[model samples]
Target: MSSSHPTPQPWYKQFWPWFLIGLLLSSIAVSTSFAVLSIRSFDGMVQEDYYEHGKAINMVLAKQQQAADLNLGATLRIDPLTSDAVLDLTGDDRPERLVLKLIFPTEADRDHELRLEHVRDGRYLGQAPDNLRYRWYLQLQPDQETPTWRLVGEGRFPDEGEFALTPGRAADS
Candidate 1:
């Protein structure tokens, strides 16, 4: 007796076709999600005015040079419990107010600028943010209509204890 062959299945009813379709759909869904994320969130790395920023780089470096020339240095201590920031500045340049900026690495919106009042000696008093924690870049400059010099440092907040800020790189070697 002859064996009858089974009926061939259509593409829609085949396992291979369904599996391929699932993979394609999954990839499309992933790409769509990525597109949405790109539209919704900012990367914060790109500057809108690249030419202007490039031009300003020299000015910034000049400020750093001024700091170095003035022998500017600072030790900053923060008390998270009391939201107090104590700054001991040492330099030939001493202003009435010091501008201290706690900048979050990736988020410009999270940056906080505190104005420190100059007290007796080299001590300056300022209020730190209550929610200070984790990594932060500290920028210390004299509070002026136009700041001429600046010092930079990096440390973790809340547990900062005492950290020193020194003049960063200058335009000239």
Candidate 2:
């Protein structure tokens, strides 16, 4: 009689265990590759060019700071007259000349510019232009800066003390 056939091996010993191990290894490798690719893309977005842009913006802000530093401790007082206007100025130091600028909130509003004429007793006088309205600013700049006084107050009318200009209201008569 023929010998009994060898017992068939269980499916786990024959192939199933190795198949499961291969599947687990392949899935791990794919996941690792995906994570690596994502990290590389994120780093590429933050380049030196982005830093340069930020520095350029900072430079512009510094220039504005320098301009503001040019004026300090300047006082402007406005006195409205029937025809002409008088501006009295007082501070630690005096400026060679004062600039009066009229600003309009909108294009429809009128704007005017006037140079203050210095008079005795630390006073400046100028003629008020017609059709001026809404808001005005008086800026004072000293001839020198060693004493630490550079620019006086801004958006101030000589007659009115520290008055904010509203859009609809006339800043200076």
Candidate 3:
């Protein structure tokens, strides 16, 4: 018999499948590791109780007489200036009344509450009493205790950019 061995396969042909498999495995590993690390980092962050608190606050607002008569698609905005809180309310329809509250945590209790008064042109104004500290939230409650009275925005007074409320954060509140 002739002394001959089968021709060796070329490196490209022989190793391509293995190389592709390794690349895929490495990509999966890297992605999995990245996801795990990201989840861990997220878990370590502070969880704001805004959503629960906000729902509770909305429930309270809805119960008020004002919210009962409000028209559809109404919206409210709370603008905290250097010294005062201004509420601007607008919608496809006008609202009969607007209710506002300053919500904050106190030294003794976590729930500190302050009520505000309607100003004009669907605007409401409130002063932050000395007892209420900075970082207090201004909540605009229209039609005071009605299911229609939704939370428009809530955030600290004289807002620092960091404390500005976002849709996601507000929803969680």
The best candidate by lDDT is 1
Misplaced by over 4 Å in model 3 are 1-83, 93-96, 105-114, 131-134, 143-147, 158-173
| TM-scores, one per candidate | 0.83, 0.37, 0.37
Report lDDT per candidate: 0.86, 0.49, 0.48
Stronger candidate by lDDT (1 vs 2): 1
Task: State the lDDT of candidate 2 residue by residue for 7-56, as single tens digits.
Answer: 99887787878899999999999999999999886644434588788887
Model 1: weakest 10-residue lDDT segment is 164-173
| Top candidate, metric TM-score | 1
lDDT of 1 at 4: 100
For every candidate in turn, the CA RMSD to the true structure comes to 3.9, 16.2, 11.4
The list of candidate 2 runs beyond 4 A from truth reads 1-83, 142-173
